[model samples]
Target: MSSRLYILLLVLLIATGGCRRGTDAPGIPEYDFMPLEAGRYRIYDVQETQYARNTLPLQHSYRLKETVGPAYTDVSGHRAYRLLRYRQTSNSLSWQPDSIWSVRLVNNEVIRTENGRDFVSLLYPVSNGLRWNGNRYNLWQSEEYEARNVGQPFSVSGKEFGETVTVIASNDSTLIGQTKRVDIYAHQIGMIYKERTYLQFCTDTPACLGKNQIEYGIRQIYRIQTYGKE
Candidate 1:
């Protein structure tokens, strides 16, 4: 089938089946009814290859803390999450605000909030200028942020699943023209299975493409969660 047809089919199936707009849908998973709980999750990620070829698929682990408050702070009240990433080999560490996220019970949809304001969509910082929302492909709307590389029938590889979402820095919009992307995958309940990121340096610095380092690790979540409480 053509890419357009495939995307149309995927969207239709997800809309009618994988994702439901109401509780009336049949065969609803038991987990769908229960409110998502607040807890900590670990994520492991690894990259398979290089831009031109697969190489040095690094691995790392991240700690995520999620909380759903009972009271309201701004929009839908207050919800929070914190993520700490640690590289196993180099002892490097990364941190994220654990941006607030919640589920829409009416349609089994997920939403996010920032600084206490509820939004139909959310953007989490990856580096200095970029952000990513996990459900973009499955989300109902893409009217929030301004995406330049937006294309019809956007494609995501099956390898992207089960990993933390990755993106470039919003501050560095210059890199936006370089075809930057955010890769995300979820794994082991609360863990991100594979998260890898790349940034095209447009500056004249040595690290800039053709100068030295063509790209930089804007962010990467490379931890494979092997065991979790089942």
Candidate 2:
């Protein structure tokens, strides 16, 4: 390669390196925050809110159960687990089939596929302020995510976890809209809580302009209700 081209290639590699963090340290329970144990499942209480231009924010609640299956080698040669999800409208109602996802851990980086989208859920060696691109494996543009509050006590939905870590997946704000996603995982237990907000405000009306009122958007919260192995 030409000298100029070689320098350019080196710069490109360095730039994309931040998209994924390299970690080979020995694993621990804290690193297993999202365990892949087969037959284990987690139940969550889902609180959803939807907003429209003229309607009051609609509120809906439900329950979700995510179950993991035995490990199998994927086409890419990575060991992956099947994730089957179910939904329940109420405690009295039986669980209905929801969706299927997949989870794989490669070099201490947790890769989860949800609805055909790939995302790096969590990174190993759980340290504070560690950042990586959650969308590095997919074709989508780089989306920065950071680990924070590592190995700290957290409480959610009346359940207190002795130690937990938070992943700030996305946080973007603008005059017209705002989008944010955060998830907390406890030691040995998977995700204990998750919250997401995608909001768009009215910019056409003077009264609501710059006020950031929810003209239309969706906000969802998932908190752990119970969990155990099947």
Q: Per-residue lDDT tens digits of candidate 2, residues 40-120?
A: 999999999999988888999999999998899999999999999999999999999999999988987899999988899
**After best superposition, candidate 1 residue 98: deviation in angstroms?**
7.8
Best by lDDT: 2
Candidate 2 ranges beyond 4 A from true positions: 1-30
Superposed Cα RMSD, model 2: 10.8
Any runs in candidate 1 off by more than 4 Å, and if so which? 1-35, 43-74, 77-106, 114-191, 194-198, 202-217, 226-230
Clash totals for all candidate models:
27, 0
TM-score of 1: 0.35
